[model samples]
Target chain A: MGLLLTEDEKMLQESAAGFFADKAPVSQIRALRDDRDATGYSKELWLEMSEMGFTGVLVDAENGGFDMGFMAAGLIAEQMGKNLSASPFLSSSVLAATALKMAGDKQAAKLLPEIVSGKMVMALAVDEGGKHNPDAIQMTASPSGNGFKLNGKKSMVVDGHMADQIIVVAQTDDGLTLFVVPTDAKGLDTERTIMVDSRNAARMVFEDVEVTGEQVLGEVGKGADILNTVLNAGRAVLAAEMLGAASQVFQTTNDYLKERKQFGKIIGEFQALQHRMAHLYCELELARTSVLTALTALDKNPKSAGPFVSMAKAKLGSVAKLAALESVQLHGGMGMTDELDIGLYLKRIRVAQELLGDADYHIAQITK
Target chain B: MSDLEQFRAETCAWLGANCPEEMRTPMKRETDGCWGGRNWVFQSEAQKLWLERMAAKGWTAPSWPKQYGGAGLSRAEDKILKQEMKRINARPPLLSFGIWMLGPALLKFGTEAQKMRFLPEICRGEIRWCQGYSEPNAGSDLASLATKCEDKGDHFLVNGSKVWTSYADEADWIFCLVRTDNTGKKHHGISFILFDMETEGVSTKPIKLISGRSPFCETFFENVKVPKENLVGERDKGWTIAKYLLTHEREMIGDSGNLKPVAQMVAELGIIPDAALQAKITELTIDEWAFSQTMSRMLAEAKAGASLGAKSSMLKYYGTELNKRRYEVMMDAAGYDGLEWESERSNDGELARLWLRTKGNSIEGGTSEIQLNIIAKHILELPGT
Candidate 1:
């Protein structure tokens, strides 16, 4: 009923949605999913998207980025949702940029320009096993002379292989610290563990990773705190994208309902189905508002992410699942089959459910 | 200077100087929260005086022009006024459908005479108005109303029943949409008419809900003659006026920033709620703030004569859902309190009553379902039957 987006946001959404609709469609995703490399997105699409400013969405314009912040990144993710675009918009653009911004690192200045310019890619290898809580890190780093030696592996790293650098979260005696490691660094072994969507995976394995003191992303033993903040920002943007996926699927389901006749009338005409679609539509809109609020709240720092992401993850994670499940269930067997893109949306939603954390994890965070 | 700053300064200073301690707690009828207290009368003399005083100055209807019985405040000024009032938790001076619903319609569609006659009473809070639109069969499919409005040339006969009328038993007047032409399409052939509830054959039977207190009523019209002069707009054009009023209804559903869901939330989640929950509560409170800000912004846009079509649905959806969330929080907090279904508990901690009342929000003012249909079809370009 309203264009909750700003005028600039509207323009940004249009341009972004247009880019994904034209540049990244379902067939390309299907091909990527089936390939041995499981390369979800190609370099060409990445470069083209970089030209459109998808990579450095939150980066300042002078740094070859959009400077549009989390909202713009979210707009891109939303468009990506429509195409199930397997890109590093979430990992490199949003999560990585937030990390650099939080670290007060102008080095991201030298690095982000290349990343924003699509010449380099970065992924925050933040997630560890058992629970997705950043504070629950088991990975370790030790003081070795003037620099730190890292002996830890971050699994479920998005675009882990495609990244030029993986920001590793490690625990130190001092506290938690984040260190940037080159993808081809001596001790780093990247075996892309396949995801259901194939294009995205858990890049697992670690050796004695040596890095200079200068390689530390932030204060020693404080990376967990920093990563938590970054993920909250990521979660907000993730919600917007979740909303985009839900919205598109709702439209798809609505179209299917109208076109597919049943019980002597189009299914859309049935009050029962109409109410269900409408309910899903409400859920999507709720998620949309909640995400927007969280995006606006991200700069509040420590107090910000703790509550905002909890709300986002709890609401969006569950809401996205509902929308995805409803989209498929309401579509009948065709939605379940690989014949349509609906099933792919569901798989990706599953990945998002695990992206930052799941429903239970977020609920626990909020409760805690 | 920002109108908000000026307005807040002015309002605070005035209240500080003029607000009486007795008026601060505007005496309200004590009752179970669901069915608002009828036995309890407002005790604050300052409230009555301020309301009357504000009505004379047209300040209560802050955005309306002084020419049409309002304070003629700018959008920013209105925000400041509301914020200042909220800062004091000032009891609402005017609370009735007349202020929220009918005034907007009269401003839009009423004749000069109609405005002169009705608007002032609305401002003075002398007359209470209720809506009569829903029919037994036409609850959601409202256009299929069977309310007959046959023209007698001098007057129109309004004979039918409107169910689920909010406070109709207490209303002085009702604005109704009745089928004026049976031959036309179902959506067409309707005329908008206003009539006095005290008129012959006009009666109300209050429906006692599961919650105990009866808020809604079954309003029936038996050969009630509404003067042709009382017809709003043209004949068979009640649908237009009715649709216009529905926007106000939907907007009302959305704009509840004054109501705090925090207390209810605390009551619902149990465990007295620690700092973490407080932090979450703060986030929710901020969301409510943002939502209200957006509503005020939309109000400004509308005042500036910008077309704000489906945005009303946006407001309604958020408002109603927030309300539901408030109830959920309450129920959660109540834990055992919410589960008590005894008739005796209906007035007390009364979880059953609260739950019953919560169900009413979704059903009224076009169910959440209908609101979505409007949004999807109009806002998102989704197909609807």
Candidate 2:
């Protein structure tokens, strides 16, 4: 596979770009943040996204999905990032759908259509602490009647408060296990955690919540492999999103450099600023290739995609951070005001950098 | 198999049968590879044989037209040949400025007589060429070169000197930028010309680098007469050619980012890196991978007929930075042994010396700062003061 997008992929990317720009621009996120919308993202936009066939990008044709693959999904993610559109695309469509598809059981088969129809939302509750350390899960799952009882706290559960169901990672006698528990189940509590980026996430506390045998995803103790597949897919697509956001930030900053005048000349005329922008451009280019390589590997060669995914996440994390900081600094005093979109991007990029796996986390993984 | 696959299979078979065992090994040193010239000596009989075999098939200059001593392979075919050769770990048959720098300019702007005369020898590796673009005062500001070329009724009288002319003392010929008129912008009134290094009043002196090696020289000419036919392209319009050649030069330097990875070097040296050192190596490894992908994407796009233009500056800047960081990590991984100077165990302090030499990577082929400026002004279209 090549680094460039094919004709069909480009067309898909263009359509996604047009849809997001026309329907849910950055102003949508601003409105959500100002109103403190209980759902965090617009339900109408999510339905439109499903209608656009974005939610089922990875599902098979038998399940009524586009079956277009992860590259197509990544292109849509990138457009969403550029527009700063809020949705459960990552949490439900990419992460939950991939987990279900990989599980390939009766439960997954039943849930796939619900996700595609936008009738149900799902969240992958992996992280237990402040940072992403999936292997260090302290949650426990014990036998309860014919099923299992889960007792643990899952932090940073993307769209957990809004999800109809949550995929919980808990420790079992065999090892790590995955259980799909309904959000309305007894003794399960989900508290919405409003993030600075104005995105939705929740802290879920499960106290003796019971799940049936059918709720278990894949074989018990073999959940690590499935979880890894799900996480890597998420990391690769998230990296694409970050790349798009960083590119837009750079473009906006560059345009401002040409128009904003200081000391009787455009600030862009300054060699210092020019050099910084140029370096950021180089970094964005490198990060773009990293993201594309990882997504292509995921679509074409899934078995060997671990290191590529880590590299893309790490590279894009650092580059997107730089892009945000430079945008703020180059925009001068106006950048600090809430009225400008630069601050919004800075906050969002900060959240994205720490979301699945930060640069340091991924770098450690690469060396390991 | 399709036509390209058929070509690949044939090419693979041909390389397997033709490339010698000794020639399949990597060069131990830069000088171990053949760079054919009038006064050159072969490092080994295998080197001579490989050059002859490849040149005979006109594969030495794979994509050039057959009339100019090449196989006239399409870009795809040439890429396949390279991939096949790399599969065998084969060394390049010949390495010369004549092939990389001068040949492309000649192909684009040379007259019929010039092409017929110079292109064949370049393909056959009969002459080694050195670039004579930079003078003492005209490095980054090459357009301000004062290397005067006086017009005469029968010939051109050239004076002044060029510094940092790589391998000038060993080269048989020089493609130089000469000042033909002093009236217009500094970029104007320049002429690109070629002349024999052994001409009367021509001389060179090797300049030693921090690596304790002398791969570059200062070349001087005092009233050296060049034939009228030696000029390439229009007089006073050589800046365009100079700019074009610089792009190729930048690309060549950027390609140096493909150096053997630092982690592999540490592994070969049998060093077990600690946690911190391992992290540094891993970071470098990832950066290297990202840089390589960028390089390949740029090349593929260029092959698809997209103009690289200012993007080459980005490649040159990032590639050199990545290479420099790789060496730094290498030195850290090497520890005290990396400080070795003048020792056989260290290959005469090869790693240390090469590490020191990487200092020039960001400085040469237009400094990284200059590349940034070009990217800003051209690619980003940043305004000027």
State which candidate has the highest lDDT: 2
Per-residue C-alpha lDDT of model 2 across residues B262-323, encoded as one tens digit per residue = 88989987899999899888888888888889888887877653448888899889888888
Q: What digit string (tens of lDDT, one per residue) describes model 2 on residues A135-189?
A: 7999999988989999989999999988999999999999988889999999998
- Report the CAPRI category for model 1: incorrect
Query: What TM-score would candidate 2 get against the native?
Result: 0.99
**Could you tell me the fnat of model 1?**
0.17
Model 2 segments more than 4 A misplaced: B303-307
Q: Write the per-residue lDDT of candidate 1 for residues B75-179, one digit (tens) a residue.
A: 667767777776776655677687778888888888998888888777767777888989999998999999998878788888899999888987788888889
Runs in model 1 deviating more than 4 A are A1-4, A60-66, A105-110, A299-306, B22-42, B135-138, B144-153, B156-161, B220-225, B262-325, B335-352, B368-385
Error of model 2, residue A327, in angstroms: 0.8
Could you tell me how far off, in angstroms, the CA of residue B292 lies in candidate 2 after the best superposition?
1.2
Candidate lDDT (C-alpha), each: 0.75, 0.91
- TM-scores of the models, in the given order? 0.87, 0.99
